[model samples]
Target: MYASYKNLKIEVKFQGQHVAKSPYILKGPVYHENCDCPLEDSAAWLREMNCPETITQIQRDLAHFPTVDPEKIAAEIPKRFGQRQSLCHYTLKDNKVYIKTHGEHVGFRIFMDAILLSLTRKVKMPDVEFFVNLGDWPLEKKKSSSHIHPIFSWCGSTDSKDIVMPTYDLTDSVLETMGRVSLDMMSVQANTGPPWESKNSTAVWRGRDSRKERLELVKLSRKHPELIDAAFTNFFFFKHDESLYGPLVKHISFFDFFKHKYQINVDGTVAAYRLPYLLVGDSVVLKQDSIYYEHFYNELQPWKHYIPVKSNLSDLLEKLQWAKDHDEEAKKIAKTGQEFARNNLMGDDIFCYYFKLFQEYASLQVSEPQIREGMKRVEPQTEDDLFPCTCHRKKVTRADLLTHVRTKDEL
Candidate 1:
């Protein structure tokens, strides 16, 4: 009925015949290092499940700001950003999602719809409308300003006021690869290869020159060849200084990152999207200390889930050396981090966070949401249906049905 140590596969049969869905798989709920508590223990469940804490965490993420005013956000965003291409206005009313945007943002729209659909399958989706910015940079207020614009975003810095939401790439892969390939967070976890004992001892990093510290990481690798092996796979921001940064390397599969024992996570434009994927792997993550943070960042504790390095990567070699000096302890940290991610960052958790976030956000609404003019309803598509609404395809209308009926009667 339940997994004792790890995931188990059980085959069910009725009188020597396989039953429907017979080969059922069971996964063990995440537990502490030496937890021998009963499977149905309420305290242990709350400690590991993270479902009950979702609302409290959402409240913590929004506590610094004033009460969220959806009407205020819907009115101020367009005037401030001028209907930017990466900005979208969303409204969830009567279990249907609607959007109003200036540009064709098919990917972000699809990501939002997919998550909402998944959430609706598990719980009643709360009615809420707010603005979201799909850009890499978070919003910054004026130096002496005094206003709270609750614009949702994927990432935010310490000084920013934008409300941080789970990144879209967690559900849809389009944002993960910058529109190149389709691979979600679960896919990344599946591809993380080799156990910790089988990986290379060197700390590994492969990324663009989006941040200057990344370039310095490569230089540090050159000095401490035994400890680190960082390189710029692509050089966009510092293309002119490519010669100084060393030759570019070919892009490798995300699975290749797990080949090393230590993973180096440095920020790009904001909080790097790769950090979540990195945390889920078997290798110990050496994260950079920066102002930018994702939604689940507050829960990550250094020396437990990850090792923290200075923002400028000043103590990277020292941290890597420490990991080498205490190999077993480092491996335990890796396992702890991996278990934490497995328990909290799953698709179900994402849906739970979204549902609770909107639920709390809707409760603070001062005015009932209205479907604004020019807003188009977004619905999921199906191949079996004769008429299905999709992101790329338009839905059949009542006017078209009336015209078809009249033509049939005349014929």
Candidate 2:
């Protein structure tokens, strides 16, 4: 059933617009100032601090697999954030999240759960919506207001003051990890010889001219064509920088990435979403340093898993030459990166990371009305009593702490 709150009035309805709309959402909570809803502005801060979109995810997952409880933990709202008994809790069948923003965003919204794997409506939005930021080519100009919640984009700085959910891509779900990236890695590795053996010695990079650093990388390719093979995937996106990106190629499939010896991983938008997949391959990834990083980046080492390039790529050609000259060392780095992804960065890691992060946030939830008390209740719609099949509670317990501290194995 649709999540309709008595308090939430569905302000507007768009007909056939999801087809026209772009799918990518941004890094932080987005607020729609144009939507003059009554209850939205007052509860805006809580929306920023928590991932209410997770409720949609939980509902969808429970609809499919009824066995998974996903370990719930409760917290009182922190004094720094609020003092009210306004509990910012995440539970199955019982989540009380005010949908911060709603639109035809694909890549950027909350994981809501693995439900994106099943449902067409990406979000069954709460009436109380937040901002809807368009993180496109040119950054949106910051509005002149004190309550500024700038989107933390993939290409955005990680140090921004805006409150955001634990930074992650929706692909972190098991569906993409096993069905998409992992399968692609396996197929590519199986079809091709090792990076040191049959791969081309030239440094290869394929992506849109989304960022200046990427355009510059393509420019470097012209100077040393023998060593670098760089091209734009869509030069059409280039209006002002057409001359610089004119020579770039149209597109490269994900499977074709393994054909090269050195795969140049650069930042796009905010972080390189492909880097995680690239690291799983045999190719030596020459990654450029950037302020933006994904959820799992801290677990990786620059020179250990993949070679780090300078921010400006001043040594791009030199780095390519060194890899060509020292093929074995480059292969070693490639092998290490593959192993790191295989052993550490799995679908389980994504679940656990979000699990822990949510647990911490739950602990600070305001504890007044408690679970269902004082809160408005719906008939609790679903095909079955599937949501949060186990372990949702009105009070904190020791079991919550144990789950929080333990790793996947411990859990």
Candidate 3:
């Protein structure tokens, strides 16, 4: 899995076509003089992009999950737990996915299916049974007996033991709407509005009142309308005091977010799933720092990829002013962040992360996974199988367009 090369040519091919600069020669850490400079020159990028860090991250995330002698952690997976949590058990065996514990969360299942389906097409997946937490927060409580049990979730915290996986919203567009929503991974990237300079000068945000900081963000926007334009599209937590939070604003298109030069990413229940979309867009992301994080968050740098803001929003006003004063620097950060996402967060990278995550998890188990009684088998939904995605401009069939359009051979 680790490589030490001397004069190696790294050619990247996508969909039967050679990527623009194919065969990037690699001689140890540095490539040939006229190589893919920034990407190839940086040892971290090469190591991370190639999947070692991803594997290591998976190991670290699951470190607290207890391992038994001979390790048979797969069979030891508990059928019942004392604490009530939204979780579903799954087993990937014989190139098919089987569900042990049923979950009604379609969004989460859609994302998991995409990962398993993508992997099944490319490689024979080893039999592994794991639990997926459907809740917003990680199931592993601090200093609880849950540490002995492995649980996978969209987000994780330093104090928790849940293995962080990619958030479901990435591919949840395939749900009830029949892929009509722009929230899906492909459309989110493709429909990011105009360039940075062309966008509005103000920073914009719109979300439900899930977190108190979000409500405060809207209040801050009212006082400083010029620098910030934040509002709650829906109010739930503070419903009794809705009058103080202003009228509930109608939901806007995700593409409309890029109209502003800055995008505010405040976590709702856990780590906001919109961070990835914000990073992919042309505008700079003013991300709120929090304990919760997605799998790729560790790779992001503050002020380099995004302008980090205090979790409490106490210094948000100051951060906004600094961004306004340092327009060009802010623009560069936005560009850097966008480039990072465009390159590293491609469909292939996501699939690679999932493959390695489960692969490593499978390796740790000594028991041969089996399909539990009453478990239902889930099938992979290929491009042809997906419903036609209705776009704003036109109704487009998933088959007619590229939706995470990578082949197993490519992976």
Best by TM-score: 1
Worst 10 residues of 1 by lDDT: 384-393
RMSD of each: 9.8, 17.6, 11.1
Q: Candidate 2 lDDT, tens digit per residue, 1-411?
A: 122122332232257344334444453222221111222231342353343334332232123222211222112122222232111222322233322222334334344433222211212222211122224221223443333222222223434332223234433334343443444334544544444688878888888867788888888988889988888867544668877567546676666767888899888767777776688878899988887655456557887898889988998888888888888899999999989877655544443334433433333333322333332232222322221111121244687455544533443
lDDT of 3 by residue, 1-411 (tens): 112234467677999778988867755542221121122122343355575555556767867654522234344444343135556678787778887554444355656766566455445566788878777888666586553677788889867878988777653442312334646555666677877678898989999999989988998999999889888888788898799987988998888988889999998988898888889887889999999998889889999999999999889888888998999999999989988887766665776677677777877776777787767888654233222222222355675355435342244
| Cα shift from native, residue 333, model 1 (Å) | 0.8
Per-model lDDT: 0.72, 0.50, 0.71
List model 1 lDDT by residue over 271-336, tens digit each. 888877888888999999989888889889999999999999888888998999999999999989
What TM-score would you give candidate 2 relative to the actual structure? 0.56
Total clashing residue pairs per candidate? 0, 28, 1
For model 1, name the residue pairs that clash: none
- RMSD value for candidate 1: 9.8
**1 or 2, greater by lDDT:** 1
- Where model 3 places Cα greater than 4 Å from the true spot, the runs are 1-56, 66-83, 102-110, 142-147, 173-179, 184-186, 379-411
